[model samples]
Target: MVSKLKMVLIFISIPVISLFAQDKPELHVGGALRFNYNLSSWKEGQKTRGGDFGYDLFRINAKAKYKGVKLNAEYRLYSQGFGGGMLKQGWVGYDFTPENNLQIGLTQVPFGITQYNSHNWFFSINYYLGLEDDHDMGLKYTHNSENWLYAFAFFKNAEELNFGNNSDVSNSRYSYDVSSSGDGLYRNKEINQLNLKVVRKFSNGGANHMLGVSAQYGGIYNLDTENTGDHLALAGHYELDFGKLNVKAQVSKYNYNTKNPAGQSNDMIAMTAYGAPYLVASEGTTYTLGVAYSVPVEWGPISNLQFYDDFGFMDKKLNDFHDSYMNVTGVLITAGNVYTYVDAAQGKDQPWLGPVWGGALSEGTANADWEMRFNINIGYYF
Candidate 1:
């Protein structure tokens, strides 16, 4: 059934391509294929180091524009099967002015660093916390100026799709698990999120700086229990860029409050059994620091090279739980349209940091205090 649906979508694209070709509509077609190789090690009496090869995913992105109106979409086929296939992002927007626009449909929530600086395929720990690359069904308005930017949005649902449910017995395999705003705390809820930033550009000095603030307020509902939960977050971030080096950092504090005390067991925001999710402290503060340096020299088959280090720390509000942190160091090499990432990472109680090798907090693993892993990802875009 899923294969047939995929075929139908593919056939439908043919005519769309023809329409663009005939009308000369602004259109583009491109995508990327990625692969991963993993090796891992565990604590005593636990699984030893092992290796595996897997397909990360295949994506097709298309965009079309006519005057001030634009349409964009991305379709994906995941090796692990994302609800048969997934629509990563699909949206339409109209530009009232070059600096202002209104967008509707599924799009990324405007919050935090739009993209994290990580060499490995997996994003930073913020991703697992619904703070990065998180998309939702909503309406959004954005404004940009020479020295300022702002965004406001309302989402009908936290997330539009997922692979698991509350009764699934185990959430270990779901892409988002409990941290998902839609299914876990804010299930069947409404979310309003906003972001604002101020920028200072130094044209002659070859540098730029930005300071931003973000906030979110939402509610959650459960049909069976008639229970309601609330989600709230406030964050501030800073960014600096020099010709060859860049720095990105953020500090955020949030709360997942529930009307019924019973919900407290799952009150923890973005709780993943292993990885960074394990580090969440119900009502705590989270901080991220990332730095990258681009090398000037380029050699054969490698047009660009960069080295980066990213770190995250979570301080729980409760005194009994331990603070959590993770550090990743890696190099990114790009040759033409092909890119490769090689990285090593270590974390204390941060399972999502080493998702491929599995994390210490992952189910069925001996609870190790610390974990480490090495990874390589190769991808091509055209």
Candidate 2:
């Protein structure tokens, strides 16, 4: 099933490519190297267990554009380089009006209030939004008018899971009967997302401030039979630019329902309820806040330095009566969730500081727990 999906995407890209061949080509290439140090254990008694020399995450991204079409791709290299891989975002878009555009292909699903705000890179602020944790390969349409912006997308449930070349496959068929032995998670899984966003700009401190609201509906197909589940999410973000300094905040709320896949497929009748098929769902809220200052610095091979920080926090209400932190916003906000808690604090700000032009001083946060992280980054842009 995975192999077939790849073929289909490849076939679709051909036409999208031809539509731009007659226009002037546009290409943009950039990447980031992030060397992170986990100061302490994210969980009280748990310690981070991956990365070489405490080196946490690194990413490389490139894009090419022609006329109204763009092709983008990214590679995320993580600790151990084991669960890191690449993804392609191919799309063609046309202007419907001066401010509205229609696009079709793999694109960013704008849902969570924090998901669309690109300035959360330098602080421990969590006041925006959070929802589905992955991207999609499907069709997307966007509209950006004067005071309002809207976006919607239809996506195939599959996202690259950093397993090397196999990052693009979605159909993970578990060989088993509905009542017997199988990888219950992927056997009959289907996923989809519908996202909407609205933004209103205002003024504060003699700077531009924008307030954004987002809503999303997502789920895997046959969630009841396949035991996947469904979710509803809402989020909001506010950005206030104050001359040389800027501040931003965002908030998010979520409600979810999920069914735990049972023992294999065909052998369920005699199963015990203790470990039987069931659902572990949750309702949660998250918030983020950030502050930044852009300072001019004339130094060796450097342009300017931006110092920033962000904080985020999330609280989860569980349905399965489990005490685990998997559903806890604090844990999931990290870079790799509980699996690697390091991500609990990270964002675009750190990379901006280290990008070769902006001198050391730029850093951001992902998790809004009491523990905060700061980076001394040096950056340069051509």
Candidate 3:
């Protein structure tokens, strides 16, 4: 059977070819190569281990256009431990009018904030909750005006690299999604998801502001039970930009109603990325806050500097679960085509900051110490 990605392309080609047959096509290509270095307090002897810097990732972006029809795609290559090669996103779209269009294939789900909800190297906690920068195999419709915008989408599932939720659900994915556990003890997949986002853009007192709301509902397929449970989420987001200063805030509540096998817990579900799976609380409300200011600098090879701090907190509905929190204070330096992020990120019960890889979004442990990581990510784009 053809994979979902291939199926969508096959189903849409005929009309796309005919609709834009008379126009000349245009193509563009670009991408980036990045590297990372970090030191974590939770590691007993990370520095002594003689390990700190390594290749992060390399990605290629391509865009093709023919009149009203367009295609966009990005593919990435990562270290084996980071899930190897993966297609970040690929979509075909058609413009029905200047104000609206439709996109199909692996596309972004409009939610919480546009591209990202954080201003630092370490994203806000919403990302771990699977509510930020999430993408899936779907079709999205969007319409916009001078100050008002709306988007609606229907996702069959998260990008399906393989057919089923087997022992090894391919972790060659860009965004976090519910999936089989690395141990294969837990198995589930996202399906039949619907999403809606609306934004109102305005300015007052010389400051531009945006207020938006997003809602999503979806099914969680339990491979063990052969039954489908559902998930629901709602969010309110706001942003402000004044001169060189910016402020952002958002609150979101999410519930994962999973249909697990007998004797299993329903209070948590598994999500995977970079070939590792971890548990996230089944129900919670997450909050985010961030502020940043950019200033031009005269330092040689450095054109600008941006200082920012982003904070995130999560409160689980279950009384017994410990809450989670994260904060990243950093500066971004831009010089020509090179950009670097230097961050001091701290978190409690967050997986990336911990000694191990998995358990980034799980129920926190009592007396868990806040872990701090000093990180620098540098990339060159062309």
lDDT for every model?
0.63, 0.45, 0.88
Mark the regions of model 3 whose C-alpha exceeds 4 Å error after superposition: 1-22, 49-51, 164-168, 356-360
Candidate 1 vs candidate 2: which has greater TM-score?
1
User: What TM-score does each of the candidates earn?
Assistant: 0.78, 0.59, 0.92
Model 1 scores a TM of 0.78
lDDT of 3: 0.88
Model 1: per-residue Cα lDDT over 1-382, one tens digit each: 9999999999999999877665565889999998887665543223353566678778899998875578989887765433335666789999898889998987777776665523345566666556666666788888877877778888765444443444211222223323423344422333344434333333346778777787877664443355666677777887788888888888877776644335435434433311112323447677888888988556878888889888887676765555666788898888989988887877766654433222222221234355676778899987
Once fitted onto the true fold, the runs of candidate 1 whose alpha carbons sit more than 4 angstroms away are 1-24, 43-50, 81-84, 117-120, 162-204, 260-266, 269-281, 354-368
Model 2 segments beyond 4 Å from truth? Answer: 1-22, 41-60, 79-82, 88-90, 114-134, 160-190, 222-224, 262-281, 318-382
- The deviation in Å at residue 118 for candidate 1 is 5.4
Native-to-model Cα distance after best TM-score fit, residue 368 in candidate 1, in Å:
4.6
Q: Report lDDT (Cα) of residue 154, candidate 1.
A: 80
- Please identify which of the two predictions, 2 or 3, would achieve the higher lDDT against the true structure: 3
